[model samples]
Target chain A: MTTIFGVPITALYGQLVVGLVNGCFYAMLSLGLSIIFGMLDIVNFAHGAFYMLGAVLTWFAFTQFGISYWWALLLVPLVLAAAGAIIERSLLRRLYRLDPIYGLLFTFGLALVLEGLLRYKYGVSGLPYSIPDNLQGVFNLGFMFLPKYRAWVVIAALLVSLTTWLIIEKTSLGAYLRAATENPALVGAFGINVPAMTTITYAVGVALAGLAGVLAAPATQISPLMGSNLIIVVFAVVVIGGMGSILGSIVTGLGLGLIEGLTKVFYPQASSTMVFFIMAIVLLVRPAGLFGRER
Target chain B: MPNIVKYGGYSLLLLAGILAPLVIYPVFLMKALCFALFACAFNLLLGYTGLLSFGHAAFFGTAGYIAGYLIKQSSFGPGLGILSGTLAAGALGLVVGNLVIRRQGIYFSMITLALAQLIYFLYLQASFTGGEDGLQAIPRGRLFWFINLENDLTLYYVVLAIFLGGTLLVYRTIHSPFGQVLKAIRENEARAISLGYDVNRYKLMAFVLSATLSGLAGATKALVFTFVTLTDAHWHTSGDVVLMSLLGGMGSVSGPIVGAFSIVTLENELSDKVGSFVTVIIGAIFMVCVLVFRSGIVGEVSTLYRRVVGQREQ
Candidate 1:
């Protein structure tokens, strides 16, 4: 009940919780982005659109077939992972030798296509996604009351983010990925099926995006345009974190989300522009980004 | 000579553009020219300079707002309003370009896009821009304070002149020593730096020129439509310009023009029929161009012409 710096502690903490909730999304999305950029040397511009698809498809599965949230959680990522693999093997693989910017452009086109098709079918409205019965209530944390679903989202996203990081950092497959990232041809010479790995890596990155989408659907609007809107901010987060470090992406994403939340509490008007402004300052001072190593 | 044929081809297209207003809709032609200028300015960066600026809509839309505000607020003539808008965008370019010139390739692109989004958010909040409604019904005014822009023909001629001037300016810049250095930096940045050229400065110059020209196009479009909307500032517009240059051919003189006209014409003719899928169609074209047809329509035609001519000579 105490006031901290003119704002009530509960109010401040509530905003921080909201910020961290959004940051969970930012962390997950940017982690996928860093993985894709690190290994493929291509910035996946379509990441957001795919994220949107996960949300939209979740809504579709439920409304059309009465599928529940648990089912969506289990089913959506697999479907998206398959779609990601197809997109990679069929199209993205061809762009590997071109300038990395083309991958950004080509994926941009793909995002447009997917979003456009969805928009054409569904219009621009946000379909309702009711929270599951188990996560429908609030948790009393004494000073600040947290919604159970929101807290679940945070925990799930953090777990997923850390697990992906661990898989890349600790596992043998992760070692191969690290090796291939450093030298794809050398890894290929070791008979590790580098091409298949590239496709799978891309699929994994997008599957992470899909998972984030599912986590986000109940909290935010499950709309076609949601992905494009969030993707820009995620891009800034990736830049701020630097594309070199996976852990950097997670930390920066979460921290920036909190900063953005703090900005919302202090100066509501600057919340949108704050991340981009930070990006400019970072580029000005550390052109490679705060966590990024020079290429 | 082949030079005469190429010049002849260009002249023929310009003449068609000038004469077509007599038969086709003047408004649509004006729209095409505005987009053509925008695409050409965009092409100047990507095609000739080898820098992909993914945030050009910031320049285009910001200029539109500036020109709209000036002409609507005061008695500023069309020329001065557009000039001021373009200068403002160029100044913005200097700031943005200075920040981004240090980064190369995709980093440069993401920085530009992020910075443009910041500008978009700024405009969205600022009072003078009229927010979501944008600055509507902006006065086109007179050229030189007396020549009436009310007449559609007069406005068409004015628009044509600006488009031609912009194209010529880009052409001259491309052929200049400055442009050569910009291309050198694009082709190989480390080598250009080793060869004693200040690469970042050259890049900044190119970026400013591109921004100014794009601003000019945006200001003109504002006058032609008498309205400036948030659509201009959106990232999608930036993507559209990239698509134009990509589909038209990057470095070639007429590629963006051909590319812009193709897209504008397609949108004009097909939007009603295709509905929202129009974006998907455009995106598909972008993917095809990037994946397979990196050289674009004009690029392919010229290459084919060369092969045919070479075979005939043999």
Candidate 2:
């Protein structure tokens, strides 16, 4: 039995694994938030609700139509993308030209309404989306018994986040998005359909949250409230990462998740507030966030 | 409204307020009055200062807990408890406002919200709050070392007096030179700064003032209800006040009072019948208010009144 810093090493490794798993979800959610904020200039307060919808609708598909986890993973994001499109077309489209606070307020209302409706249909006692038979085994990673499902979750989340980062930062379409973010009017002047582009960008951003939801279903209990509490923490992440950078969100989220995990290992009570404690400190030190560029 | 109509309307409203306890349930009115005070305090920042402090319920609910605990443990008059709660809230505002005012616009809202949730988590975990059971059966105590507050009617008038005092304080602040500076900062911060105002200090002061008043409301509510709970400090309460201020009309003195009364009545009406549907209903109301009723009930009525007055002049 090996020990590090006079503490059991296996326990440390286990907490680190859990932290990485938590980090995956945080990274995915904050990634979506950063994308929407960068392109559409709206905070997407309903991002958490959309994440909950992903879990709920995926669970819905499973129970109603016997859709497997694999299929629902593909289907849920598309379904939520359509919903996002509709929301953008109906409500959010009117808000882009106004004060951004109006956008924040609009999404806040949408979140409460959506969560309330879900709770109305399915009582607060969360439904379970169990691990598939294939993903149930464990891997003895030398130090700890790592669950196979959790590894898949981390891989899948990282892949999704990486692909999103590449699509927005590397490809030609990515160039347009980056350009669009800087000056929409200028981008529009170049024969680009900025409105349609803005709408699609928002949908994609929401789809990323939906993808995160599907990934999180087996990790946590599938509940209508899955997103509400998590969203505030994500908001703190967005604040700490600043709204200016995409990579900032992904990196900060993962880092904080690890920090929070370490706090759990040392002092369980402070685990809940550790990220926020970091958030306050970060704001005091760098008002624009770690990777934020002063605009 | 003309001077005659304005003064007459105010007199009539006060008269109705004085008589409301006779007609309406005193407990219900006390509830409304407390919420009305909370909303108005919230309005002072949002309506007048143009800083949307989303964490106000932290002050409102924390004060309730403090006041309730003091009244339960000590033999001090309720006035002392309320005062201490209010000052403590002001101190909290000073700290929170320090962190939050560093960011502007949407970030300001998010910071306030995050900090409020931090407080909520603290209250949730702290033993002093009594957790799920809450601080129950708090004493109303003597209002001024003389008047007994155990009686329902006495408590109602006490709440009313506090409500009036809080409203008048906000009213005067809105009309004062400091308020003018705050309003100038709200309308255009850069312009206000260019004109040589220490905008941060003004904003922080308004935030503290709003918080202290909200604490006053919460303290009164605890004494009135004879208990305090986490619900007082919850984000939902913060959202409710935002809804009230917006629905009644932001940037107006009387808007939050109307908004608070209507929402409390609406909650009273709907909670029994629909239960869970109340959230959905409130959300829908929020959507509708933001979408079309940006001016709010009182704001629109005043606009109409002004239009009619202009027509008469023409």
Candidate 3:
């Protein structure tokens, strides 16, 4: 009933929720990308493909095997983590010594392979995945009616992001990861299995994408293209955030998502380009990103 | 590296361009030539300057759309339409290059890609782009008010001339003093800076030139096909040009031409047979190229030739 700048309060809140949910996904994906970049020194361009695989696997688990969304949320990440580990050990390891750009190129090819295979199998159509029965209804939050599934996505993403941040910042393993990222040779000299750590780091990063994919499956259309499309936006988020710190990516991602939501309220046409517009401005003002230290 | 080998290679390419249209499908050859020029343009930045732009398609596709709009709506002559398109792309290059030159390596690639996607989104939303359906039924239109491009044969020679002209420009640029400075920056940026060369200025120059030439190819392709679509601007087109440059041999003059022709022919053959799996195959080729053939076809051949000659001398 209330109006904010000519747009209904309900509409504004609704778009904000949508933006927040989208931001959560961006946070998770960029967090994974940043972590992988820190450890492996590669951008892991296949991250989007892995995310798509997460969603696709969720769809497959549900329709073919009668696996519920609950089970998928548990299993998809594990499966993708395994796949990530294998890809790192076999394909990515050879690329560490080359220019970091080659890593981006190689993973891009990997993404194409994944997206192409799925497209060939499923066609370009978006296969529907319904929200579970428990999370189907909406919560009347006084001002706006919020879908239960979307609320769950936001909460779950925050939990995952916070847990990841804690693990890297507070835990001893996180210390090793930070150390390895800084100087792998010194870490290796300390008798740590640096290569294995790199592999695990990639796997964990990929698992984060998988988790994001699963979170996104019910909220959006499940399609082969879902990841590639989203990943570019996340890249803008990463650029804006500067991949400097875990908190930076998480904060930037959510913040950009909110900005995008506000844009939708005033100028829906620019919603898509809003993040990019911000990215250009950020690059001009602080090329190191909002939270990133200049390397 | 010898002048005789270089001149002989150009002569051979010219002869083939003249004779091949008669033997193969002219339209297909025209497509390959356009792409060859595009790849050559891309190679100028990647090979000589060590800048990997993942958004060259922004220039290519934007130019195509602009050329199509001007020729179709404004009724501009084809030559003027293309020139306008090329200049527009150069201007875009100037703006984008200025923003991205501060970043290096993967950051550079990512920024270029993101900016290109921004352009892509704008085109998708713009009324002139025709959104998903793309700009269609563009006229082939005559050049110089007399030379008709409606005929496929007449157009093939014209396309060949344009391709050669673009390639020649790239060749000249690569061998010029400016190009040497680009190579210096590529090899060692810090060293180049120490040597008193303004590295960013040289990079910006290369980016604009690369973008303009890529625009030339895309604008010509619109006329040859008489249609301009969003596919021209898609990131996939950017990746395709990268693949062509990588597969051909990035630094060599003949590499991109060879790479473009090979990829175009391969895509043409595979699209009909594999249908939906063409992307997978292209991706597979990309992975293989990066993993096993980083030196590329030309680079490998040259290395092998040098090795054999050294062995004989020994």
Global lDDT scores for all candidate models? 0.91, 0.88, 0.93
Compose the digit string of candidate 2's lDDT tens values, residues A168-241: 88899989989999999999999999888888888898998999899888889988887988888888988898
lDDT (0-100) at residue B177 of candidate 3? 98
What's the best-to-worst order under DockQ?
A: 3, 1, 2
CAPRI grade, predicted model 1: high
lDDT string for model 1 (A1-295, tens) is: 5987788877788888889998988899999988898788889999999899989988999999999999999899999999999999898989989889799999999999999999999899989999999999999987679999989998999999999899999999999999999999999998999988888889999999998998888999889999999999998898788888999999999999999989888888999999999999998888888899878
Tens-digit lDDT string for candidate 2 (B139-254): 88787777889888888888899999999999999999999998999899999999999999999999999999999999889999989999899888988999999899986888
lDDT of 3 by residue, B108-151 (tens): 88889999999999999999989999999888889998999999
Q: What does each candidate score in C-alpha RMSD? A: 1.1, 1.2, 1.1
> Model 3, which residues run further than 4 Å from truth?
B1-6
Candidate 2's displacement at residue A28, Å, is 1.2
Greater-DockQ candidate between 2 and 3: 3
Model 3 DockQ reads: 0.89
> Where does candidate 1 clash, by residue pair?
none
TM-score of each: 0.98, 0.98, 0.99
Clashing pairs in 3: none
Best by lDDT: 3
